[model samples]
Target: MSAKVPASPRFAYKGDRLKPLRAFCQTARLGSISRAAEALFLSQPAVTLQLQALEREFGARLLERSGRRISLTREGQELYELARPLVEGLDGLDGAFRERVRGLDAGELNVAAGSSTILYLLPKIVEAFRATHPEVRLTLHNVTGAGGLDLLRSDAVDLAVGSMLDVPADLSYEPVYRFEPMLITPRNHPLAQKAELELQDLSPYGLILPPQRLTTYRLVDLVFQQNRVPYTVALEVGGWEVIKQYVAMGLGISIVTSICLTEADRERLATRSLARYFPSRSYGVVVRKGKYLSPHARAFTELIRPALFEREDYYANGQSER
Candidate 1:
């Protein structure tokens, strides 16, 4: 006698039954029914049932399970490729429509930015964006430059702003601003009286440098190395704020991006321009290649474009004319 097969659940009609396409796509992409279930907020058995239903509908096994792991078959891979975008598009549409109905100006905007940009640039932009779109939810992930780049690559945030040492081939960058670096020292330091000082002249002072990996640190290093000027590094900190505090306490003099200095920083310490030429560091926006920008993201980018690009042009042309 043939073995009896287990009965599948009966639906009143195909139209009334929820299509398991979404669940099937999730499982195939994630490679685990449990993970798919957690992402979709469904029970593990329910996710399995959905996948089983999908396989039945297609008349072939979509996944092969071994122990606790899963892998898609060839046919499953093709089907998943076709279905993933459709399901993701549907999800995007639903979110867009709900946000629209709530209000044209309402929805969350997530931004990832480095600490220096957060201190110097982000507050003004955030205030302006909020004033214009008060109903919109805004979130910021504060990170170092490398951390922000990692977040962008991992799809953790919609946008990031910071100083990128080099633009990755997989990412796009737009210059937001460029500012020269300045030498910072304690208020009573002897170099404070000079309007500008050469790099060679400061070789004897203890330096508080950004960690060696940072773009700013590399830029400073290149200038000193090329000139064969040796300086003592007394401390290395990751963030500009920490570097500034250390300088204020007389730990060491440091070279910092001018944007990182504020009125208070100047009052508490002293800044002098470098007599030797060093390249200006650029602050900019970075986005993952081919990521779709929502309406709010587009608008925010537009609002910031002038501050990033046009103002610099204005300054450049004005200086030339003068």
Candidate 2:
């Protein structure tokens, strides 16, 4: 009798080899097999079998269970970080391929930006992008603070264009523009007429500023505190336009970023460089660490700054830093 042929390892299991990894990934993410099963449309038993096969294949425990909850082991966490992007990329491959074929003529791009960025920084970029890719649907989420970060982490928006003083490890910030810190007051204000301005020079005046929660307020406070210069906030408001208007109406002198200062603003409000006392604010593209940017998203970012993320590592491992 002829010797029995050996079974090929590749065909040992049915369907895609990726099924086990996908199952494992979902289970690891949801932390409950039942929830992962519900998400994957597979029964809990099937998911369990897949996980078992995956652990056997890797010869390491990928997960640990206590009661009904689950968590990844150290090995599992490392694998998750490496495998997640691959899984996500494959899952999006079909749509991505279609978009590639159709080009920018058909697709949607979502961006998150605060009101100031949307108003000042993105206008020219948006106008140019719209003129070029008018058919593409673009939505800008006007968000700030934690809201914008939440959208980015959830992949609700493709990327964010705004200022970031503190960047999280899971996100990447590429600051392309830097604006000087400026002190804005009504044209006739005494502080505006000073040949030279010092941080202590404005301590007597109550300042009109954005809410204390904003970075501007915190940065200003930090500087003043560092110098032992006491300052006061006369009014807490939102929006650059509103702050400039309030300052123009002589409510109080305010410290502002030059990003929002225009020719009209310069005419209405006398502005002096506070760069000596304050650091320049940086604005740029913010993306999730391992996000796969759609072509529409990539195109929009290119308009903001040419050849942005052209390096392989940027879209590849999402490890690129600027």
Question: What TM-score fits each model?
Answer: 0.65, 0.64
TM-score of 2: 0.64
lDDT for each of the candidates? 0.76, 0.83
User: Which one wins on lDDT?
Assistant: 2
Question: 1-322 in candidate 1: lDDT tens per residue?
Answer: 9999989866333453334778888887788889999989999998887777777778898899877878899889988888888788877898878865674345667788877777777777787788887877878898876777788888877888777767889899988777766778888888777554667778889899988887777877888898998978899888888998998899999987777766566467877655346777777788999997767777677677555443343223112110
Looking at candidate 1, the ten consecutive residues that score lowest on lDDT are 313-322
lDDT of 1: 0.76
| Candidate 2 deviant stretches above 4 angstroms | 1-105, 306-322
Q: C-alpha displacement of 51 in model 2, angstroms? A: 26
Candidate 2 local distance difference test against the native: 0.83
Per-residue alpha-carbon lDDT of model 2 for 240-275, expressed as tens digits? 999999989999989888777765674688877777
